[model samples]
Target: MIRTLLMIGLIGFLSLVFLHAPVRAEGEFGGLALGNGQLIFEAQCVGCHVHGGNIIRRGKTLKLKALQRNHRDSVEAIANLVRNGKMPMSAYKDSLTEQEILDVSAYVLNQAQQGWN
Candidate 1:
């Protein structure tokens, strides 16, 4: 019985260590490195906002153009809006990590600067 218990504890400890291991650097999200921004965007935003196309959501148009313009003023604003869920836009605070939001905002900002028209 003692051996079984010790083995179980060892397995649990190793699992926790692996889970807490630092993720390798992928890209920047907000100020956070090793962020998973693209994955979050792909899962959440891509549904309504297609690749440079217009989609009607809750009676408001979700176009890349509008988002690009909105992102111009501030990345923080975009992040906050996504976090808090601006009207006509669902709040992603529960769905995404803060870093993910920041990364998505960065992606939008980059697309805007490039004039993704």
Candidate 2:
């Protein structure tokens, strides 16, 4: 029925909105301010991850190809790697709170998709 079709469309629209909402969460700065993610990236992740390149692991670049191949194409995958760490990458789970990890993950994904411009 038309009712069922309308409900399906509504559900699809809602799902898109929820999935794409920015994860700019409140943090040490005190409020849900934006760009803190960029700041965190600069202070913490920029050294090796600058310009989407991994200084240590050349194969694990943040560019779309490497990310996709390593099964890290999603924000959750990146966040988990950052929190848990692997090999040369030390764990930030203790250093960064969950919100900070989420923010940085969003930043990295956004930057990577833009070719790290």
Against the true structure, whose TM-score is highest?
Answer: 2
Runs of candidate 2 exceeding 4 Å displacement: 1-34
lDDT value for candidate 1? 0.61
- Give the per-residue lDDT digits (tens) of candidate 2, residues 1-117: 999999999999989655754445454434432365676787798899888898999998989889889999877898899899999998999999998887777777777777887
Q: Largest lDDT belongs to which candidate?
A: 2
Error in Å for residue 116 of model 2: 0.7
TM-score of 1: 0.55
Question: Each candidate: what lDDT?
Answer: 0.61, 0.79
Q: Could you tell me the lDDT of residue 41 within candidate 2?
A: 80
TM-scores for the candidates? 0.55, 0.70
